[model samples]
Target chain A: MAGIVEFEKHPADTLKVGKGFSLAKADPDATPGYSGNKADGEALLADLDGKLTALQEMLFAESRFGGRKRILLVLQAMDTAGKGGIVNHVMATMDPQGVQFKAFKAPTEEEKSYDFLWRIEKAVPAAGMVGIFDRSHYEDVLIHKVHNWVTPEELKRRYRAINEFERRQTDAGTTVIKVMLNISKDEQKARLLARLDDPAKHWKYSGGDLKERAFWQDYMDAYQAAFDETSKDHAPWYVVPANKKWYARIAVQQLVLAALSDLRLEWPKAEFDVPIERELVERS
Target chain B: MAGIVEFEKHPADTLKVGKGFSLAKADPDATPGYSGNKADGEALLADLDGKLTALQEMLFAESRFGGRKRILLVLQAMDTAGKGGIVNHVMATMDPQGVQFKAFKAPTEEEKSYDFLWRIEKAVPAAGMVGIFDRSHYEDVLIHKVHNWVTPEELKRRYRAINEFERRQTDAGTTVIKVMLNISKDEQKARLLARLDDPAKHWKYSGGDLKERAFWQDYMDAYQAAFDETSKDHAPWYVVPANKKWYARIAVQQLVLAALSDLRLEWPKAEFDVPIERELVERS
Candidate 1:
């Protein structure tokens, strides 16, 4: 909500989470910032690929030569909301060298032994990396709240911890982009059915998914509560509509583009005497 | 190598390290399995992207559904030899979620305290991932041998340790691909000059690059000796002719395609009751 004016020139502003915003009021089918159709969205994504890839390379190069700026893109969404599609289509062109991706799952017994942030802290992108998290620390506030996995007081405490945790990331020069791939229950039903129909995609479906879907409204309430509690100036949550897969991909790509472009990345300057090195390389 | 005949249908065989292979004999300009010009190579690479990406996705999907198979593609070469290029162009299409890349540099104080393979072991990709090492344990043998950084006996021990390490990986359902992007000294010189000439690329240029180029023959000997000692049936090193950037990219892509295809991947079956899940999802 605070970033609406900050992102005024970008599509990100259209999806910005304003204070007291309700998920029910937003249309998952709405294109928001874009007036484009599916083909247009795809074409624009393709056009943005070059600038995105270049900026990513520059960011990576900056880290290698002694710079401390990185990007952490945290994606939160219902199942079949196309988080994976955003990664495959929007970020597939990036040099894997500069990309770090982790999809968090149910915590293991060992993970349960430590603070929830312990595993997350280890996965933070180092300088110059674009770290993509499929599901992240917000899960503690979202699902943990929805499922009553923790005490209500403990769940409330997690919100404060998440906000502070993200503030620290900003302190350490990590630009955090938190996104909720907003999709409707109907859209989820259709997608789940599509998965059920396709043998090739059956591996992605599970009985647990429906159990979660049964709590759809509760989950929506959970997401809104989490957003209200943790969304901040440095790492505000932007709810990109997910019903139209093409639009979701393009919007997320544009958000990343704006974040990187804001950094105004430059190729790191040579750390050696260029003239001397040039001569030496010439003789060799 | 032991894998030469095994890789005969692919370009990998043409570049394979046989029992008594000599680095001096291999021409960097030769396009072994391919007879095409640069344009044809580019066309083939474009054509191969679909299959490569599909295979990577299938491999990732398989891992998520109880499959344990994975790949470790170890890239070793001198400076400006196109290791990064191969990753950027060849792996650019695959989902970043499935890739884990590390560019091994000179070890730090903590890393140097452990066995050379400790950091390497940590970086090995988990189930269903493609782990790429820009430079790897082979550095302990190749560069260490070139610079006499380790005692000859200790350096020789590392070869044995590396062989056993790769064997253990294969024993654990990991397929290892070792590729030495073989670029001629002249090609290296030209590339270094090109980097020096372009301000944008200057960050990649290093004064140390010249110091390393001075020991070109030593590096060649180091590479040959290491290959002779450690290239095994499970992971024989492929000596790719890398002067033609297009040829190297295409050859490496084909090699990865061959490796993933060898696994005979299929879409994993639903782990839950499909009928029950479908019924629940529909009602929801």
Candidate 2:
């Protein structure tokens, strides 16, 4: 309540990809629906962070008591786009028990043996849990499309498979929320250099980041194409401008709050005779 | 700073097991080593919780740069002793990425097939991570011992095996800290009744809890025996008084901080050429 926000443009609308959405049209630095400065965004996030704990507990409680609903947040971004930041600041707000977090790296030999979706399916959130994927099934297309590892026909097939796979998840009571942390080329350059500039941050940097930056436009085009192919009414993608870290954090936190709020969860009614159990406990 | 305490006795010294330890000597109502009232205990937890995030990140950063050290906090307690609360408040202070939490329920048919340590071996903390076991391999002995599911000879064998398993963990750079949350019969009775009294908390109650409570004395005996058998130089056990929830949280958090601080982790040094990456990034 201390950092109450009445959004000039609600992220649910401004960030959602509509028909004919294009990567060329999105401005990486614009705070799309927010009328807040960095300080205001931080305050908004602080106010909202504590709200997640109770909702998460309700979800976990429901899961134990026959509730099938769960939440999945898929994070996709290029290097230095602050994907890890989202996981640290946003997803970690929930009790770790209620959060199932998996950061997908390159496929290992065992993973390569199966279809890409094989691992992704295994990582889906169970009833009443929130699952966060740092990089996900989207990699099979995003990276592969950039590298041309998959044939055009195969790429198209994989896209269709992904949509079907997500549909199955939703049908099984998982709400999929995908987020793309959008950073401009200049912002990324600044971030990568900032990491290199500091001794403590070296572990987060890799020489290959520069190589990937060269394919920036190609990756963006791949993302635009993937959104066009797979973004749906059930599982929509939201693009959060990440040039300002504070704004991106608040935006994603709002998206999470929106999805959980939609569940209309209530404290479940007691299934047993309260008097009987209390009497039994008192006697013990 | 707000909740700083000059300890009458540090938990490290007061709560640790000695040669002839018994659970009966641990007063669940006593706030050992902490001279604070409930309000003071709450302040201590708030001040201490913020300290974990930086420590956790340094450990994670170290792990990425080939540091082999990690921390493992094993939690053992009776029903309603607040194991779930510890995980939510204490362990959740760190990044979920750095914390691997597993709450052991009834072992499955598959688990029963393998040796008891089989499932546990797979869940040990990797380098630079902190692993918390809400209930651990001790259950294999505690419950099985209480139910007479194993012979005295088999129980002795399992105890030695657990010690050996933990030694291997420590030898491989894991600082294994085991804690048992001590609570009284009276307190557990109150907790069960409170759960039954509230509709929101009814989900946390189970009919089987009464059956388990009937074996309270037997379970306590089993715990004492297990501690005497398995407490070692490599993996010592600590008994924390849990009649006061705030005291338990701060005690466990202090144990966590002591374990991590003992490692003396510093921010990692830069592994790449700053000038080169800066030039390349600039040109891009």
Q: Pick the candidate with the highest lDDT.
A: 2
Off by over 4 Å in 1: A1-9, B1-9
lDDT of 2 by residue, B87-163 (tens): 88778768777888887889899998999999998889889899999899999889899999999999989999998
Off by over 4 Å in 2: A1-3, B1-3, B6-8
Across A1-284, the per-residue lDDT of candidate 2 in tens digits comes to 35566468778889998788987889989898888788788888878777887788888888887999999999999898888788877777788878898889999999999999999988899899999998999999999999999999999999999999999999999889999999999999899888887776887888888888899999999999999988898899998888989888988988988899898777777777889878888888
- Candidate 2 to native Cα RMSD, angstroms: 1.7
TM-score of each: 0.95, 0.96
**Which candidate achieves the best DockQ against the true structure?**
2
C-alpha RMSD by candidate, in order: 4.6, 1.7
Q: For each candidate, report its DockQ versus the true two-chain complex.
A: 0.68, 0.70
**TM-score of chain B as predicted in candidate 1:** 0.95
Looking at model 2, residue B143 earns an lDDT score of 88
List iRMS (one decimal) for every candidate: 1.6, 1.6
